[model samples]
Target chain A: MMRHWPIFFLTGLLSACGGGGGGGGGSSAPTQICTELNTPQSFTSVPLSAAPSSQPNSAPVTVEAYPTYGNGNFNIPYVTLQVCNGTHCVTVDHVIVDTGSYGLRVRADFPGISTLGLPSINNGSTAPIAECSQFLSGYAWGGVYSATVKIAGEATASPIPIQLTNDPNFPNPPASCTSSGSNIGGLNGLGGNGLLGIGVLIHDTGPYYACSTNGQNGPLNTPLNAILTNPIVSFASDNNGSILVMPSLANYPQGELTASGTLYFGINTQSNNTLNSTYSILPTPATGGNATFFSATLNGQAGPYPASFLDSGSNELFIPPLQPPGTYPLNSNGDYVPQSLQTVSGTATSLSVATDTAPLSFSLLDVTAGVNAGNTAFYDMGTTNSATAGSLDLGMPYFYGHSIVNGINGAQIQFNSTTYTGPFYAIH
Target chain B: MPYRYRWTVVLVGAIVTGTTHATLGGLERDVSHEGQPIAFAAATVHPLPAVPQGVHQQTILNLRSITLTEYSANGTVFAILWSGPTMPDYRSLLGTYFPSYQQVIQTQPLSPGHYRAPVAIHQPNLVLHASGHMGAYQGSMYDPSAVPTGLSITSLGIEP
Candidate 1:
């Protein structure tokens, strides 16, 4: 038995904008499990069944919240990585879900998993253990290992990867890697036992492999050696990808009321769901690239928004860069660097970007707000030495009170206007 | 929704022979990998991850262009997928469509005189079909004008 591991912003009412940043309150006594948003009335906790291809074209499917693990202390609704060696299936229950980074990372202690026998990662000179600190998250350090990860009904065979955190050398892990030290604002809470990232990029953390940056083979570069596989890639039939559909919420009497949404497993292939023809569609970057909106103009110019992304892996809502007075200072590698702020500019208020469209403006909502902005350890914006350097991230704030869908075939995240009509509330 | 067309046009330069230069087009979307066509005018100087330097093979890069055929449904282009000189492509929780097409262009690291300027275009020709395709939005294209002599054009098509 081994413990798993793992790990947003915005706006203004034209000035009455509240302070936004992804963080949690002081560490409470370890609770029993993860906390889930209030379930929606429209939602029915359908039994977790195999994702069926082709659903009757109908209204959105309401997904019930799965059971929470880690005793509900921000560790509920955990995703499991089942390692199967053909005959037997060993489900790793301590797995965490994340959308900040891509790829599935499994531990080596699991029943039927094997670590890739990669050459020792030496920084050109010494053969040191290769570790990787991904963007906005802690350093996933350990020896390389490979395995076949099965999620739901999907799986990827003998993926190249690494398994750290539980490694001895990694003992006394940096706060950057553990909840005790580096993680600020209680975000470390979202850093569950393990992570299942569902971001819109291809390579996790902007493709900055150790070989690329330091000529060393690190986890980000050789994640396959570290058990990093896209869970969607391992599914059965509609394995191409999945989606996350949410409801369009309106601000309630107490400002933005708490709302809920659904998470699906496949695309137009699900029996309970239908690719809604009404909402807008925005195309995200291929892999670990930045999630760009469809406009170049600042202040709402870049659009094709109301865009949906079915990412259960992240802890907050990651929008695009906002305008001035919107800048935030962040720590990278150890040095504090200023994050550039770009506005979402466009003529149209509501927009959607189809499959193949030109590039546009992309902004991100700060996800660390309710956690307290004054706290420095609240947010760990990606590494400073990353190939695709940026200070923005989508976290729990992005999912708070929203109906979200995940694990679908076609890669998309939609919103149902009926369930969530909103005035957007504070995530405290 | 106001129909606004957009296109990407690379700045043209005299294609020099004998001297190999790295011609960089504007940022286009690489739909195949959910990445952007990041063109690096000056590479080969340093080795970056994913982007291996030193012209191992005459790699084929898909030169692409995005056309916003319609905006009646409130649609817009999201990202430009390019490698080398720009942002790396990423994976999404859910998959998506691509506005740019993959053009297989034989590209290699720069040698000498191996420098190309960046291309830029505001909006260009993007034709929608006759069927029920609504013509409510603007369209655009991105094509390299300064291709070296003796180079052959393999495939050319407009992405959604």
Candidate 2:
């Protein structure tokens, strides 16, 4: 329905780009399309971990971080979650802690945990709903089911809606979601069993289906309480947002490896997650929504891409191509520069060649405050040539040296008294 | 059924000619112009509006979830850059190029990035590199011979 994607080659949006009102990520509101329920229900800090003795079961909720079995580019954080249906409790591991999206999506079966024989949430007429979580490279197709989900030692609410990728019964996906992308929610695609999207949006909306007679596409006119859900709102307290506290790696590993970190539940609920003032407050609002940028410049050219946000799920930081769409600009023949680095971590040295690109410089405001006051990380985004409709993506590589707080969608984040409804990421 | 509508070129009530990705590599630029005029539509894809690059005239077609760039110089299609939600339907998008594509794509080690799949194919007659994940995907294809003498792919915002 469109003719020449006309939003490229902009100098104006970049000129006015102030960046990171810290109002980013997650949906601004939970609507028929994207659901970010600003449920009046309050959430508190409840840490659930395999090593409960080692980590607290209270506020500043922390989950362990580990490396994936095959791929090592991503920091695969595992949260022990219990999916219950008043009948049985099923726990699983290798749930990626991704801040790029929202909602809880898992496989119906794990290595040790069997199928989550949960009940389905039909569209009143009894036709079940299927969700297609569309990724850039692919999509994850699954059926919508409800079960009491436990994350980090606490139960947000019983019977929260979730999409089950591993469910055998509803394995058949409607063709609408697959027409554009393929399903990668399985092991080969995500490199994990499932993803725990704690980003700003409540529901990961892509293509929804009313599963009855082989299924149909578009939005599934189901009620908010029944569709895919971000379990945070169901918590008794600390529902506003969560924090990812990944410690600096001693040395970035260049091969299949492992590391450790933590994922906390609320932003300001406890002393551990209290919004620190020194950090920059950048707002990453829901897709197609308006927000700010810290400030950006490319090739000494001011205002190329305005803002840059964080996504733990993404492995590398992708910057806009040096030259505009039709023009090629770089000293390198291709966009990638296969470079490796070995840094001294404490007394030891570590090497990592995760990104195969040259060095690049892009500026960004940090974990807390205003725009003019921010930091820039060195990266060689190496000429990424996609037409993504958002600011630059500061993936897992960007999260390495920093601790970020993803303020919940529609939650209020405050710098003293200057209160703002969130969808923001505070990085330190 | 988002993007299943196929409109074969009906020019002035007649079928005009164009090129597909496979055959376009060696064909004239106009063949491509005729082949893919508008991909999907979007707000980020650039409207060429007759913009000029090093030695080419370019317009970008954003297929909602994809971005296809058309470059022409010396009266022939020189190079094309495509980044889409999924691999462009290789069947039609690849056309004649599909035959030799698998040998290059499957044999090459999986390219790594934020997106798990990184396809780097460099056949004798064609060269293409594509990668994507989540909701953003990108790729570029070009015939080394079709490119202008002094021009490089990097000059066209393409990685080497």
Q: Model 1: per-residue lDDT, tens digit, A339-359?
A: 332223242121223332222
Residue ranges of candidate 1 with Cα displaced over 4 Å: A1-77, A86-88, A107-133, A155-164, A169-190, A201-227, A245-262, A287-314, A317-394, A400-428, B1-160
lDDT of 2 by residue, A230-277 (tens): 677666556777777665542323312334566777666666667666
Q: Candidate 2, residues B1-160: lDDT per residue as tens digits? A: 1222223322211123322222344333333332234443443322223324445443333223344665666545656666533334343344456556645534433222333434455677677665433333455666676677776566565545
The candidate that wins on lDDT is 2
- All models: lDDT? 0.27, 0.47
DockQ winner: 2
**TM-score per model over all chains:** 0.39, 0.59
Docking class of predicted structure 1: incorrect
Clashes of each: 184, 72
TM-score of 1: 0.39
